[model samples]
Target: MEIDGQPLWVAPSIYVDSKEQGIISLGHRCVLSEHVMLLTHDFSLDRYSEKMGIAPSDMEYETKGKIRIGDYAFIGIRSIIMPGVTIGDGAIVGAGSVVTKSVGDGMVVAGNPARELGTVESAWERNQAQWQLKRRRP
Candidate 1:
């Protein structure tokens, strides 16, 4: 569900890591592009093999966290939103970036690790500068 007066758009192909605890959340008017992956859990087996350690499938409780995308946030295509990430309002995440840490409000972050590039002046300006609201013909 979307917050009042804020519309959320997520691509059809967006994949959630798990069907059960895929507790990825969106505040309002968030835009998630194609093939975006919301990763909610990480397995111990990924680090420790079954030969030496517990398998990921065997583990019941794993490292998991919720992802919160604040209002008006734009997540670019094919980006991976890791567990325990909070993307603040009016933030712009560049394409194909891996978000490891929380992003502050109105911040523009891009790259492999997704570092801070700059801050947006205002929500109005950020929306105007970055995205557009267009109407389709009937």
Candidate 2:
């Protein structure tokens, strides 16, 4: 489903990690890649129930947050995006990155914690070049 021309790439294997319904609003031209998981739940071991030594099911959990991916955002393959994060317009997430916070517009990021690598425009240009090169081969 799309909202205002934005594309939400919800794959078959992707599940919203929240027991609560996840609300997503994608801006214009946002593209979520395959196998990307949008997370909304965080489990803590601090607060626990005496009986099972586990947190109650209805305990105070921060699970209600909207994930907003801005215009022209490209989430790479197998990336896990946490809740309440707004990926800015034109930001590019490298493949397998775990996004924990908001990304700036036109920025490119990668790694387990998703650090800034470069600009999205630069990455896009490089990717296009690589795709063209591959097309010409064989």
TM-score of each: 0.76, 0.72
**Tens digit per residue, CA lDDT, model 1, 53-104:** 5565565546888888889999999999898998999898999999999999
Alpha-carbon shift of residue 59 in model 1 (angstroms): 3.9
Q: Highest lDDT, which number?
A: 1
Error (Å) of candidate 2 at residue 45 is 4.6
lDDT of 2 by residue, 1-138 (tens): 226573645446665665543366677867778888887665453344534656565665344467878888888889988877878998988899999989999999999999999897787677775654444322
Model 1: residues with Cα > 4 Å off, grouped in runs: 1-6, 44-49, 53-61, 122-138
**Residue-pair clashes per candidate:** 0, 0
Model 1 residue 28 CA deviation (Å) reads 1.1
Local lDDT at 83 for model 2:
72
- Native RMSD of candidate 2 (Å): 4.6
Clashing pairs in 2: none
Q: Rate the local accuracy (lDDT) of all candidates.
A: 0.81, 0.75
Candidate 2's displacement at residue 56, Å, is 6.8
Give stretches of model 2 more than 4 Å off. 8-10, 18-22, 45-60, 124-128, 133-138
